[model samples]
Target chain A: MIRIENVSFKHRATPILSDISLDIPKGGVVALIGPNGAGKSTLLSLVARLQPLQAGVISVDGLPVDTTPSRDLAKVLAILRQDTTIASRLRVRELVGFGRFPHGRGRLTQEDDAIVDAAVAQFDLTDLSDRFIETLSGGQRQRALVAMAFAQDTDYLLLDEPLNNLDMYYARALMRSLRSVADANGKTVVIVLHDINQASAHADRIVAMKSGRIIADGTPGEILTPDMLDTVFGFRMRVETIEGKPFALHQL
Target chain B: MISAVSKPSLWTGLIAGLGLAVLFVLSLAVGVSPLPLNKVLSDPEAMQLLAVSRLPRTFAAVLCGAGLAIAGLIMQTLSRNRFVEPATAGTAQSAELGILLVTLLFPAAALWVKTLVAGGAALVGTSVFLATAHRLPPQQPFLVPLFGIVYGGVIGAVATFAAWQADLLQFLSVWTNGEFSGVLRGRYELLWIAALMVAVAWIVADRLTIMALGREASIGLGIDYARMMQIGLVIVSVITALAVVIVGMIPFVGLAVPNIVSRLMGDNVRGTLGWVAAGGAGLVLACDIAGRLLRYPYEIPVGTVMGVVGGAVFLWLLFRRGGHG
Candidate 1:
């Protein structure tokens, strides 16, 4: 379980996350939904220990984020942020193999190689494996980055806006991959998503934030109402039931 | 990811290594006074010449090249800019500043003493460069190195002023223009530390490669980003200081070799480190050999040749289509 308590973060006097508390139990998909600058990404970063906890307590699997050794914490949780700017010229297989560094201390064992191959296959990146990262299209590159995080084999995966460069087709494909990974491996996937419908379709729970505070938290069916969407996004949107799932018509 | 045609395969490494070995023998032969190959078995003078000057100069050139290139690789990774290196980042100038300060205090200080102080100074200066580069927008990759060149120039200007005041201008000239004429066996042994630093880089090549993924990805991979950064700083500083101290400034080996090697072999340091080391050594040897033969019996400083050649390469890197950012 990832537990966050009264976590308040300020970036040079501008409150980014203010007194936010949330409990994310293991083994399910939880989507954090909000407008831009609503602290969804910041909260995910805190839970994954990407940033130092400034105000309160955060623990993953009962180990406090601030105190736990990063290596130990990494074994349990892995995070993939939106800014995935790679500096070096690296091949896709090599990039995915790096995800095994935490486990093997830079040397990939046979087991680690198998895991990497599995991740490469899982993301359907077999053909692109030998190509350099810079040569891939933006969506393919994002998929490669996701494949790397998946290869990490951490129980809790915190992805902040992983769907950024992906097109609609690949975006749905990625969502399905994450959903299957969570279900098959019993991994806790905490994703910050901008698409409400993607969240509605794949997410087991939707936590909505507005102004650094949680405005709504429940199953997608309970939180996708027009009134709840307005409270979180600060605008009203029409909602319709499609295949027993709430679909918000926010774009039209 | 690019599917580069040149992978660092065994044949690639063997060919590069063989080429460097040939260059090494060639360097030993093309000097002002040739040690007769036939007389070397019976001639003590030839042996003395070989032991005293030829071997030391050759080793120093190779070590200097390999070390600076490795340092440049680390610096580029740390700054996340392909163009940044010790010479441009104020590291070499800072080492000069430290050596000047030490010379003023203790004119007879040991070379090691000067080296330690210079390395420390270089560390501080490079840290400042790293911090400043971080604040600047990384999207504009050229800006970081432009800032570094300006910053290094300021430091270099100050060092020049100090040398002028102390009437140490001649000393400055010798150190600033690198050549092997002054290298006797005992004088050039300090560059071996740079050889050692290269080994250290090899041992930690994987970690350094991970750093190229940026701080967030590196940390997520269980690396302590700050510690790896510190390691990078130390490697660059020590190598820059020692190279500057031992044979003076041999520019561009660090900058050019890493860039070219990565283009050929990709940037997985485990695979590229050997090629980088070989490429660096080969470049300096080739430049040094050219310096010796350009006007036979009257040598040009290797530093001058490198500056001219490296400057041209730098411009090409900037202007070429499909060039790196």
Candidate 2:
């Protein structure tokens, strides 16, 4: 389990996250849903140690996130933030190869190369593997980035709005891929998602936030009600059960 | 598998052999006296010019070019921007200021002492740029080098103003313009230090590449980001300062050469590192030869010729590459 205790963060003078505390269990997809400026991405960044901890403590599988060496932490958790753009003309496979750097130190062994190839195949990017990243479409590039993280072979995967810029088909495909990976491999996949229906469909649990505070936390069945949606998003959304899962219809 | 991405073997061999041949011919045949091949073989005075004078000048050009290009590559990688280089990072300007201080304080300081002082000041200047960049938002990746230019410009203005008041503007101008003429028996030996810095860069090229991927990426990969950055900055400063001390300021050779090579090849730091060195040496050698042939007796400074040509070519390359910023 990943446990965050009394975490608070401020950007200069403006408070971004306030006294947030939560425990995320392993082996499932947990979607963090919130309105704009609700600190969803900031919280993910903190858990990944992309940003330094301002107050309180976080532990991943009993190892303190701050005190642990970065390489060890990298083996345990991998994060892909939104809008990741690097000014390099690198092929998709070469970019994926970097995920093995913590282990191989840029001199890839047979096992590291196999892992990279697996990630490429798993992401259905075999054709695009040799292509430059800048030449790929938005959805393809997003998949390539996720594949890079997958090649990291971490237990915990944090994605901030992985669905951004993806079309409806690609978006659902990505969510389904995350769902199966979490179910089959027993990995902890935490994602910040803007699509409420996607969260309702793929997420095992939903954590809703408002004004930097966790307002609701429970299974999707318990948290996807119109009342909770109104509380978290300041709107009344239609909720219906289909195929033994709650689906929130917020479009319109 | 022999992929299309790989450079052709023949092309590589041809470029390497031709580059070496041109550099050797330039070192032997062209200079103040233009010693014929026979005279260089038989005459002692001509032989001294070939060994001590023309030869060192040639070596200095190659070493300076290679060192500065590697330094530029490191700076560009660390900043994660295409346009950044030691030349653009206030490093050369700060080194000039250090040299000025050394000359003013001790009118007869040793050449090595002057180089040390210049390199120290450059290290401080590069550190200041990096530290100040850390405080700003990460969105403006290009701003780091842009700010460096502005910062270097301010310091350069101050140096010019001071030199004007001291009535030593002529001497200071000659020092700052980056000449290969004074590179004779006793003075040009300082540039060998730059070759050592390039060797050090090759040894740590992997860490530098990791650091270039950004602090989070490097840290995530279990690399010490700050430590790697410190090493890169030091390497850049030393190379820039040493090159300046030996041959004044060579303008954008650092920025232009590595950029051109990386465009043809990929961003594999190890692969690009050697090509950058070779490309740098070739470019500087060609410019120095052109400078000698153009004015004959009057003789243009290689640094000034490189400034004009590199500036035009660099702008063309920038526009061709769709303008980085």
Best by TM-score: 1
Give the docking tier of candidate 2. acceptable
TM-score of 1: 0.98
Question: In lDDT terms, how accurate is model 1?
Answer: 0.89
Clashing residue pairs in candidate 2 (N, C-alpha, C atoms within 3 angstroms): B178-B248, B178-B249
First chain of candidate 1, TM-score: 0.98
For model 2, give the RMSD to the true fold: 2.9
What stretches of model 2 exceed 4 Å from their correct place? B1-10, B38-46, B130-146, B321-325
Clashing pairs in 1: A131-B1, A132-B1, A132-B2, A133-B1
Show where candidate 1 strays beyond 4 Å: B321-325
Residue-level lDDT of model 2, residues A1-252, one tens digit each, is 899999999999999999999999899999999999999999998898778899989999998888888878888998888888756666788888888887767788999999999999987889888776777888888888888888988889999999987888878888998998899999999999998789989999999998989999999999999999999999898998999888888885
Clashes of each: 4, 2
For residues A26-105, write the lDDT of model 1, one tens digit per residue.
89899999999999888988887788888999999999988988889889998999878875789999999998889988
